[model samples]
Target: MSTSLAAAPAATSRRRAPEPPKRTAAERWKRRGPLLPALLITILLTQLPLLGTLYYSLRSQNLLRPETNGFAGLSNYATVLGDEYFRAAVVNTLVLTASTVVLSMALGIAFAVLLDKKFLGRGVVRTLLITPFLVMPAAAALLWKHAMFNPLFGMLNWLLSVFGVDKIDWVSQFPMPSIVLMLTWQWTPFMMLIVLAGLQSQSTEILEAARVDGAGAWATFRRITLPHLRRFIELAILLGSIFVVQTFDPIFLITQGGPGQATTNLPFLIYQTTFRAFEVGEAAAAGVIVVVGTIVIATFALRVISSLFQEET
Candidate 1:
């Protein structure tokens, strides 16, 4: 009887399924092995160029003076940093970036709030607004240069003549402002899209409550809408700063870093150093500095956004 009972338990145990084995890290990776090829390609495309740039930054790799090409240590960086042009470039970069970001954000918020409300043919209007952003940066800069700002024959001159005013040489007289205006015109649409998303995602209940409580449009905007869009505003400013600070196309196509280097930002300076002055190492170092500064700002912006998200949750 005892033997029969033991045999019954053994048979039941034999019929039962075993638990699945835990996957190791390698096994997990293998299971998702199809992504490996694409990831490797991305790394090759991005990381390889960055590594090459870093290596070149550490060496004296002048195309003009190949004989002087070798490991330069930090000498190239010192030279670039010590130059007066670099300091001026930094100042110009800050001015252009700050102006563009501020003006874009303001215009974007205004447009976003306006479009968020019901309107006739709003979709078509939104598409038209976003057209400038979709245009290529260089092409847009060229358009602004020749079509709008041309001293004698451009639209601005024509408009001034219509108004019985003096024609302004925009690029020659106000190079930085002209560049800022072009960039702001192009990038405002991007900021509007971001802010619009934030506006649309807002709590309808709160807005309706504000309306029911007799809160005016300005009051509601100040109390509820503005608070909600703060993070979006920060995000727009951060992104705009990153792109605007590295502006090259407008400076190149519109001003060519002139009216006496008035529009020469870091990227333009780097280009001037590399191609115009034939100082590859110095340009590489400047490029590294710009990249590092961008990364730092991006990190801070991301952290601020994350904190805002956490607060909401």
Candidate 2:
């Protein structure tokens, strides 16, 4: 009886002792332990500038006179919104964003489609196509502003003169268009590369089967390829729009926001306000507005992307 009781106690004790909780989860987590630190650091570094901008937007702290400081709440925002130059900047930015995105996507998709087909010098063509994206923005801007659009001294005017056309100052007559052209030249390759990646992701078998089913090229593209690349197209548009709206280098180097504020974008306005006019508070306000607008658009774009990813899965 004592032996049976002793055995019973031993068995119960063994059962009560928790099996060393499964080690795999803990081991896997330990392996991934660096992820949190990296994420936190990334977030901190990325958000610090924005946080500072937000802080300064609410206070009137002009560099020239720091003593007349006061918290103006949304007064700075009101001031920026009511400014004529600021309005022009916003309008120009929107125009640039729309035109560039549409043109880039159309041309990019066309270029990608052309490149997708096997042909002579296909590799060379791709290399050439991607070349513009690699050009230094400053150097390219300088070339466009001076070498190409210099009216009497410009290549564009020289070319126009060959056809008996009068020389017109590109900066004065077509400032926004000139900026758009330069930006599109720099940016279209980006859309092309992304769209091509999406194109490559389509299954060869599906395309073959479509061809076997008597589907024409247009039908295949519209019905099969376009549907498949919708996500990528959206991604390209979003990326291009983001860059176009905030484009600084070309505008700075070429237009300097001028010939009567025609091509001045919000970014330039912010630069002019803070740096040139030395209105720190107003610049911060512009910065906050820009950040908000960007965030809103980005959120919508990401939501679409997420939906597409879900559909793809």
Candidate 3:
């Protein structure tokens, strides 16, 4: 019986699958022709501007002093590094991004857990929760500024008044927190959607087995569900950080980077440098730095995602 089994395996191994024929150049071109226009357009839209920015960053160009435009080497970068406002902006950007991502992810996980359970009006509740994310950033900022955070007649102050608390100017007094709150509110729904998808994809059989083994809900979640959701959580953090790091609308609309430079982040600083200060070269250098930082983060996130996928497979 062992000899016959070994012979059968050897026979099967001998009958290997046939290799596919290689296509001619024309055939390959025919297949790829349709995608060429889109590829070209993408290069034109993305790569060209990046190259232009790099070129500008090496120059001493200022819109206000056009005649003085000349090659600056790395002076623009040096200027940006030496500027105290730039350092402050970098710190603010990190703080804002970290705070918003953490808050949003926590709330998202809570909401997703609640939504995952079968309950009446679940659909309606989920829809209402998602409304904040669906609203335009500009509109959301405006709504928070006028309808919620206003010291005089806003809903928050009105609620405070009922408890005999003084009306507080939230944006002016707490610019960073105010911006973080708005961002967290908007981004929580996004994180919830990702986590909810992860939860729904879990195996009912495994959950039932855990329950049968005398594991409680919290134990099952902590041991099984949480581990399963790790990838989803990482993905949510990555995407949330990418978006929140580029936050501009809320700061611009609500505080205009604050009563001072209190709320100025990298993106806002770049805007100020280019349009407000008219320092084209410095702005370009800053823009390049921001792009490089974002790319580094995205690359790391993608590696994590790839490793997770390999583990699952």
Q: Which is the leading candidate under TM-score?
A: 3
For every model shown, the clashing-pair count is 0, 0, 0
In model 2, which regions exceed 4 Å deviation? 1-33, 307-313
Order the candidate numbers by lDDT, best to worst: 3, 1, 2
Error of 1 at 224 (Å): 0.4
Instruction: For candidate 2, write residues 131-219 as lDDT tens digits.
Output: 98899989999999999999879999899898999988998899888988878888889999999999999999999999999999999
User: What TM-score does structure 3 among the candidates reach?
Assistant: 0.91
TM-score of each: 0.88, 0.86, 0.91
TM-score, cand. 1 vs. native: 0.88
Between prediction 1 and prediction 3, the one with superior lDDT is 3
Instruction: Judging by TM-score, tell me the better candidate of 2 and 3.
Output: 3
Instruction: Residues 218-289, candidate 1: write the lDDT tens digits.
Output: 999999999999888888888788777878888988888998879899999999998998888989999888
Candidate 3 per-residue C-alpha lDDT over 74-145 given as tens digits, one digit per residue, 9 for 90 to 100: 999999989999999999999999999999999999999999999999999999999999999999999999
Can you rank all candidates by TM-score, best first?
Answer: 3, 1, 2
RMSD of 1: 10.2
* Model 3 residue pairs with clashes: none
- Model 2 alpha-carbon miss at residue 33, Å: 4.5
Q: What is the lDDT of residue 157 in candidate 1?
A: 86
**What is the lDDT, from 0 to 100, of the residue 47 in candidate 1?**
87
Candidate 3's C-alpha lDDT? 0.91
